[model samples]
Target: MKRKVFLSTTFKSLLFLLFSFIYTLLPLQAQQLYQPAEQLGELFEQVQLQSVFPDSKTFPDATPLASPDEILQAYQQQKDQPGFDLRTFVMNNFEMPPQPAADFRSDTSLTVIQHIEQLWPVLTRQPGNDAGSLIPLPNAYVVPGGRFREIYYWDSFFTMLGLQASGETELIQNMVDNFTHLINTTGHIPNGNRTYYLSRSQPPFYALMLRVLAQQKGKEILTNYAPALKKEYDFWMEGANTLNAANPAHRRVVRLPDGSILNRYWDDKPEPRPESYLEDVHLAQESGRNPEELYRHIRAAAESGWDFSSRWFSDANSLGTIHTTDIIPVDLNALLFHTEMTLAQMAEMQGNKAEAKRYEQRAKERQKALLKYAWNEADDFFYDYDFVKGTTTNIPTLAAVFPLYFCMAKRKHASAVAQKIEADFLKPGGVVTTLNRTGQQWDSPNGWAPLQWMTIQALRNYKHTRLADTIARNWTRRNIEVYQATGKLVEKYNVEDLTLEAGGGEYPNQDGFGWTNGVLLKLLTLHPELLQTTEQEAVLQR
Candidate 1:
């Protein structure tokens, strides 16, 4: 027994020295752990909670049975028991439900609006340490579907669009404040509330959320959110001060051939994502390329929120050929362009003319860069540029709608983009994410709520009223039909085939979809004339 104690003490000392060495040598931006804890006690503690306890019961039934305080106490007090099994201890002592009480509503008779209202109560949560979450929002916040119980970055923008139209302005403000808190605490918001998501963010939608508020409230609200939004803009422009022609790109900032700056999807960590653990690990093993390159591509795709999509892959059909870091996405830059414009307007509202002018200039530069690189003259559409290959990508996607959505495109450009979308992109259900048929959820055959909102509004803004109405009617019908059939609004729909359900992702399709509810409500409010008829809801054709 004494010999075992001596060995444990020596091992702990070695781990302490290793941990100190890593902290000193590699100070990552997010302070993410490079490797798991090495000390046996720490390692054992992690395995018990993160691995043993988590993977023990599977999700739905997997919400932690103890409060964070209680769990921590149990871990501290009895973690050193001989042949310790924390899983058994938790099971015996806790009263966790078998499954998350099958979402509160099952009545197909409820109107889509009624269904959304029901979800508001079902999805709202107070600050707590639920199984997979650690959100710190002061007021209740809505979450997306299964396994996504935390407030997500980009998803909230579209979700708030519906919230605003529903007369729930305070909830929207509360969510925005939660994001503000995250930005202030973490320097930038992580992908979600989890500690593991700190190394990256999804599309920069902080400014857009403020835009939604300003439209409902006056531009004066911008003054309150201006600093937080600027902090967000600065997060995207972190390495811009040092960028020169020779350097060209560093972190999120990318310099085009014309000496103008735009942003790209990027993640500081060159490693697998914690949420999609097994999927990433399997990808790493199968990828013949350098593991670092593969990890960066995976991380970059997460930043785009179109993980495993053909849009970022060198071979559109092959996930193994993904090269996300080398591409500057059209939608991503357009969103940032809006951010720049919003910051300028907010500064003007605050009577800061100089700051406003600076941001206005930045917006102009980004607009010019998009027209120069993303526009395809012959195709009359925007495509993501392959920065490494020095050419525009061949894929045609709904992302082209953004230039019109932001009013950044010329009338001629909007005309061409609208014509292309009408001819190829629009389908029986709605506009697909892309024309490519790659079996990723973000590719053909799958239509998501946020993209549907963006495309419909962009078309209407460009005066393609007929096309916009057609797309909106079809898309909303899908939402209503699926709700009528399954009594649930889901994450994606079958836009291409139109007969089967949407598929292709790391997990099965999910319901209680926050953005879907948001976009559907906003559309119904915008064009109340285009209501679905129960008398004879026409069958969607393939």
Candidate 2:
């Protein structure tokens, strides 16, 4: 029996609009066994769908049948055959689709820096006339390769940092333009520019992206991109406008007992995600939780960009306990704070006095609410606030760095956070993503490029330069070590155990990494004076 929570009709109608946008959730991965429906439109249902598509190695990401016309054709041709094997039929009709090939090989002769510079050009993709699920972007952008072919929301920001280092300002400009285009079209940037990711968004990093551009282009970027930034801010602040003391929370906005508002990760989606179709279905069956609730929570985690991590689980070790929508991530609120402040800055720059004041007040309110709810003085570390549970969670992740990263933390708080990171977060290779190694890609051992950048930046923000340099060095060394060995950079690294490749979550480790190259480039550029030139030369010589 599932417990029901009644919601107001107005809120229900709002979610209905959000849901209508997410229609394409088809099973695309190979090896990932997904039982589909009998037929969705012209497509085969899960039953026949499983038999039709092969494994991940063979079929990847909303593939084998790219269109409704193709699906209709496949069923029409195979319906009469008594022994219709969907896989064989697909092969017969469509050309044997092969994954994109790389031109560069594992060349130990090249320095890791040189190898990365080589891969940057390869990772940078222009979609151009490329059709299908590799959704065409208006601008050229870097992709974290392997399975990913589309531009992601937050990934591009960190990736842009490296592009800046590579003197690729044009690429960064294109990335911002692409995001601006997305905001103009969709009201906010989706997690990635995919039809399936249409229902949700990743971490609200648009403001940060603008900041990166502003670093190069000056204050003009704020006014120039103000409309897109305003659209994004409005998207996150949608329900908050209508919210009042009588009804404080709606959608992403949550009004606490004291009438203070903060945002929570949310997705209007309530189904098995097409990309992770089988996994979502299997988890729903096994978890025994309300399937719709679980789906929403899972989707919310994706919005949080710490997808499938222990931080979202009610029980630290179990995927079944995932309740992502229940907690308010420190990072999400911090990003929103940045967004609000950025909006205010832009408004003031444009001489919009009334709008500037409104945004500034909003930022102040959020900062106060965040400190009240998210800060844990007892632990001397920031923890995600469990809005549903009514306390700070025990789980401590790199999200703690956000306050310092955004300059929200007080000197005392910043001092404590820097110490905490130095003591627990840092590893031999880099900072482990989280203390928990729950076999999720976002969990321990998997040190992602974005988090590494945030952590290093935060350390430097509080004048912990030596510690920041250490982290930057370790993370850069790990990235270089991996590149030297595989002749490639990956989406994430196993910072905890450098000997093993990073593993966990839905897919295999990805290479031609967008953020990896970007962060390395930016870090190297930022601390060129601190370079271990002899050590790097020794590694390359071998």
Per residue, candidate 1 scores C-alpha lDDT tens digits across 483-528 of: 8778888889998775699998777788888899899988887877
Across residues 412-505, which tens digit of lDDT does each residue of candidate 2 receive?
Answer: 9999988888898889888988889789999887898899999998888889998898888888888877776677888889998889999999
Model 1: residues with Cα > 4 Å off, grouped in runs: 1-103, 128-135, 532-542
> Which candidate should be chosen as best, given TM-score against the real structure?
2
lDDT of 2: 0.76
Give the distance in Å from residue 419's predicted Cα in candidate 1 to where it truly belongs: 1.3
For every model shown, what is its TM-score relative to the native structure?
A: 0.84, 0.88
Lowest lDDT sum, 10 consecutive residues, model 1, at: 1-10
lDDT of 2 at 363: 90
Please give the clash total of every predicted structure, in order.
Answer: 0, 12
